[model samples]
Target: MAQKERVGVVVSNKMDKTAVVAVENRSPHPKYGKIVVKTKKYKAHDPENQCQEGDRVRIRETRPLSKTKRWELAEIISTKAI
Candidate 1:
């Protein structure tokens, strides 16, 4: 089976080598049929601590590196503009 991958923006990188990423999911409500945007936060392992807030990054599912970090940073899609 293919591993899960997600692209989202880094919301926080306060931890030593962990980053909080916010991924948005858009889907229509089952009954109302109205589109809804739901945001979820995932803790991804950033071994290099290269991610900064607002940076666009790709994360891949992996073995748990920590209690909350089950995803690892794949690559930085785009860096936050200074």
Candidate 2:
């Protein structure tokens, strides 16, 4: 099976070797037929600890590295501008 991937913005990188990413999912409401945005936070493994808050990154599904870390950072798409 192909591993799942997600593109999201890094929300926090306070933990060592870990980063919290917020991915947004947009879908039409079942009853109202209006677009709704849902955000989910995922803990991704960042071996290099390169991610910082507000950075855009790509994460891929991987074997659990820790209790809540099932995703690994693939690449830094864009960094937060200073």
Candidate 3:
């Protein structure tokens, strides 16, 4: 089966092999019918530590690798030079 994937920005890469990504979603409010922006953060396993803050990335859902890591780095959509 294909795993769930998300496109997001790398908000932090302080861990040795992990990155924190923030994914944004927009939806209409249930009652007000106004657009609402929602952001969620995910811990993704970055085996090579290639991701950095401000980089755009694609992450895929995987078996839990740690307490809060259920996603793995799939690809780097864009890079932020350090």
The candidate scoring highest on lDDT is 2
How well is each residue in 1-81 modelled by candidate 2, as lDDT tens digits?
A: 999999999999999999999999999999999999999999999999999999999999999888889999999999999
lDDT of 3 at 57: 98
Off by over 4 Å in 1: none
Query: Model 2: residues >4 Å from true position, as ranges?
Result: none
Candidates 2 and 3 compared: the better one by lDDT is 2
Query: How much is the lDDT of residue 31 in candidate 2?
Result: 100
Task: List the lowest-lDDT window of 10 residues for candidate 1.
Answer: 63-72
The alpha-carbon deviation from the true structure for residue 18 of candidate 2, after best TM-score superposition, in angstroms, is 0.2
lDDT by residue for model 3 (1-82), tens = 9899999999999999999999999999999999999999999999999888999999999999999999999999999877
lDDT of 1 at 77: 100
| Candidate 1 vs 3: which has more TM-score | 1
> Residues 1-82, candidate 1, lDDT per residue (tens digit)?
8999999999999999999999999999999999999999999999899999999999999998878889999999999999
**CA lDDT of each prediction against the hidden true structure:** 0.96, 0.97, 0.97
Best-fitting candidate, measured by TM-score? 2
State the TM-score for model 3: 0.93
